[model samples]
Target: MEHKDNRYTISGTDIEEVKRKNGQSGMSYNEAIEWMAKTTGGRGTAIYSDTNMEEVKKQNQSVQDYNKNKA
Candidate 1:
């Protein structure tokens, strides 16, 4: 039942699905978004045209670079 910018696309069911899939995996929301982006072969915010695609790219890249450094 998360609402963002007056958009009500995601429902409680969706959250449950996400939680179920993330069980014992410790996947944060950002990690899920990144994984979805990689799996779908598209930028994560492709559905939100108002979002800056470049920003998403930078975020995804930053996460990857951080993981690389951490490892």
Candidate 2:
């Protein structure tokens, strides 16, 4: 789901949305994703590689754990 932006030469899913949320309306690609992960609910499970996916799942679990404790 790569959304290509001709103006900035960047690509990602929901590039405009990510940029809008981050107040970086020009940012794109991995920067957008990492920022979104930090700001949003949890780092989503699905990623590029199997090993990385597992790591993301673990990180997501930790995030959920922290939030659960806070609540």
Top TM-score model: 1
- Per-model lDDT: 0.66, 0.62
Error of 1 at 9 (Å): 40
TM-score of each: 0.33, 0.30
What are the per-residue Cα lDDT tens digits for candidate 2 across 1-71? 54355434344356556567778456657766766665663447235223465788999999999999999
Clash tally, candidates in order: 0, 0
lDDT of 1 by residue, 1-71 (tens): 45673323454246655556779678778776766665665554455234577999999999999999999
Instruction: Give the least accurate 10-residue stretch of model 1, judged by summed lDDT.
Output: 5-14
On a 0 to 1 TM-score scale, where does candidate 2 land against the true structure?
0.30
Instruction: Tally clashing residue pairs in candidate 1.
Output: 0
Question: Clashes in model 2: which pairs?
Answer: none
Worst 10 residues of 2 by lDDT: 41-50
Maximum-lDDT candidate:
1
